[model samples]
Target chain A: MELTLHVWRQKNGQDSGKMVTYKARDVAPESSFLEMLDQVNEDLIKQNDEPIAFDHDCREGICGSCSMMINGKAHGGRKGTTTCQLHMRSFKDGEQIYIEPWRAKAFPVVKDLVVDRGAFDRIISSGGFVSVNTGGVPDANAILISKQSADTAMDAAECIGCGACVAACKNASSMLFVAAKVSQFANLPQGQPERMQRVSNMVEQMDKEGFGNCTNYFECEAACPKQISVGFIANMNRDYLKASLLHQEPVGKA
Target chain B: MSWIVRLQKSSLGSKYIMAITGAGLFVFLIGHIAGNLLLYFGQEAMNAYALSLHHLPYGLLWVARGGLLVFALAHVFIAYRLSFHNRAARPQRYQYEATLQASFASRTMPYTGTLVLLFILFHLAQFTFHLVAYNGPYTDSLGRDDVYTMVVNAFQNPVYSVLYIISMLVIGFHLSHGLSSMWQSLGLNHQKYNLLFRKLSPLAGWVLCLAAASIPLAVLVGVIK
Candidate 1:
């Protein structure tokens, strides 16, 4: 099958980018979207040109490494699937696919179809982890979490740090992503020590990052491979509001 | 700290402001429509309505009007800034087509707002200030050329009534997303309120739309004349 690709190409973080059209031939209908890109890269190598760069690893989609904006969607037109999981069968023969990187002011383009998602990392570092000592594993029953709490925690923990939520949001807001990280710990007893601090600091960090605000589009949920609910966003909001209200800065108003 | 500065400068801040201002606007629209509803009774009744408002003690009227002005300015400023920022971030329309898959009102706020802004200006000129040179006769709250009666006489013109009705339809379009967006901005995240606001916003929007649109339709059709 033949495919017309409108692939974004950027030299580096400093340079502006443009969409370059490439005619890819002999694509296999059974091949995944990454496989089709591999074919195109091979052709580029034969022509002694720099292959279009993109991000993918563990092609199985669990690592949250495979990222691309196929057409207008975050991980292509398919729902609940990553780019590497999307197969050519989803596209018609002779189809034109628009591919680009995860876009947000925080996630600057590091290279073609690759963005610096370090903002998300900073958000996590601010408070995405439990304060349990890492010297040795604690007893399994040290904290007897209710079945419901454990289940809800697991649901929030399913987030893979992909920037799809930010990409899908009209404002490029990462509320869903930040909310998931906050909810995972805040829901469990192990995370109680830093619960208030975690929500406050992480939300502050998220704001420091260039991500936009959530506008209730629900596009983030629709685009998210894990389908993290917007409920967590509400939880984060409640916690943050409480924290800010209680811990007023000594100086000027927040 | 600079971190706080950076946070507020981000796109998220604009959306927050949008949601907050939108909520205030939604509340204001309801009151405005309710006030307009008096036109249904008769000229004397509507004029008394305006007179009642003017009779408020202290600086209350000035405060309300001042607050409204601030809200309108901030809302329009924030919306324009956000839209421009969104455009700059994209720099180009999507190569592939995408649909909103939402209500018609949800889809056209940006465009409808532009029209509504013009309509608002015309509205202020025609009725608020009596500066539009409209030949229609209007009786005031104290039985003078009050703006409320101008509202009635203007609606008597089918053309004016249709314009008002169409503009209200646009307002409905604006409200649909505006209300939800505001709830989100206020950070009202409890699932109970989330469901409550979702149900409440659309109903409120529809009520305002119906009430506002009904006035002109009634007068134009001679139901209220």
Candidate 2:
């Protein structure tokens, strides 16, 4: 199959970028979207031109390293599929695809089809961890977790920290991402020691990162590769409000 | 920072304000529509009801008015503030933008909300302040302010009725997103009622606006006479 690609090209973080069109000749239907881009890059390299740059790791889709907006939909608009999991056969013969990096002030473009997602790391660092030492790994039943809670926690844990939620949100809000991280810990017994602090700190960091607020549009859920539910956002909001109102902590120097 | 200030500065805090104030204003609209529905019962019922309100013993009406004004101002204030912040979050927009699930009403909320606020001001000017179009120190035989006649006079003009209908549609559009989003913002989510919560917005929006708009259409058609 052959395809027409309109790919955003930027030399570096400081360089302004534009969509540069290219032709993909003799492409295989089974090739993943990233593999197809690799072919395009190879052709560019053979011609002594700078190849279109994009991020990818573990083409298996778990690392959350691959990020791009294909035709303006995160991860190529396929449900529960990452860009690396997207196949060329999903497109019609000679189809034109527009690819661009995630658009968010927090996730600025670093190069063609690559935006820095370090803000996500900062948000997680703020309070996404269980600081208390639970001492050695215990017996499976020692924690006394309900099946329902375990499932809920696992569901929230599926979030890959890809900024698709921010990319797809009209406000560029990272609420879904932060909510998932918070929910994953909040639903677990181990996360109880600092539940209020975790939500409060993570949310504060998220807002400080310049992400917008969720208006309950739920576009982020639809664009999510892991199909992470927006219900986690509701949980996070509930927890955050409770923390702001009821959680008492001593005023101390930083 | 103070916890109150922390809450105010947070993104979720602004949403909470929008949701709470929006819910308050929505309830007020329901009462407004229910009261106006008395128009179908003839001038006596409407005038009597209006007169009873005018004679409230301890300025309770002023309190309610004050509360509504505060709700409205905060609602509009947070909406624009969030809108500006939201716009700045994305300095560049996608060239081939396509929304997977955001409804048309949800996308145009700020615009529709602004239009509805303007409509509310115009409506208050005509009906509450008696400052536009109608000439009357109108009173019924019982010597009460003739609110029924004032409302009928205002709606009798085709242009006025048309403007009113259009404004109601815009209000309905705003409510289509706001009403249901209120629950979501308040973190009132459960799997059992999620579908109901989602459906609440459009269903209530259509029903409430249709009922409100019906009064003007009825007046214009002389049905109230």
Best prediction by DockQ? 2
| DockQ of each candidate relative to the true complex | 0.36, 0.86
Per-residue CA lDDT of model 1 for A151-174, tens digit only, reads: 999999999998888777666778
- Candidate 2 chain B, poorest ten consecutive residues by summed lDDT: B194-203
Name the Cα RMSD for model 2: 2.0
* Index of the highest-TM-score prediction: 2
Candidate 2 per-residue C-alpha lDDT over B44-154 given as tens digits, one digit per residue, 9 for 90 to 100: 889888877777889988988899999999999989999999999999999889989999999999899889989888888887787887778788888888888888887
Report the TM-score for the A-chain of model 2. 0.96
Candidate 1 regions with alpha-carbon error over 4 angstroms: A134-137, A248-254, B1-20, B57-59, B77-94, B97-118, B140-148, B157-159, B189-195
Question: lDDT tens digits, residues A1-254, model 2?
Answer: 99999989988888988989999999999999999999999999999999988888899989999999999899988999999999999999999999999999999889888889999999999999998666887677877989999999999999999889999998999999999999999999999989999999999999999999888889999999999999999999899889988999787889
lDDT of 1 by residue, B1-225 (tens): 754554345554555667776777777887888887887777777777787788788978898899888888878877776666554443334455343233455545567777878888988887777677476665554556565556667878888889888988887777877786566655675655766677777777878898889988987777886
User: Model 1: iRMSD?
Assistant: 3.7
The Cα error of candidate 2 at residue A198, in Å, is 0.4
Considering every candidate listed, which one attains the maximal lDDT?
2
lDDT by candidate, in order shown: 0.78, 0.91
List the candidates' TM-scores in order. Answer: 0.87, 0.97
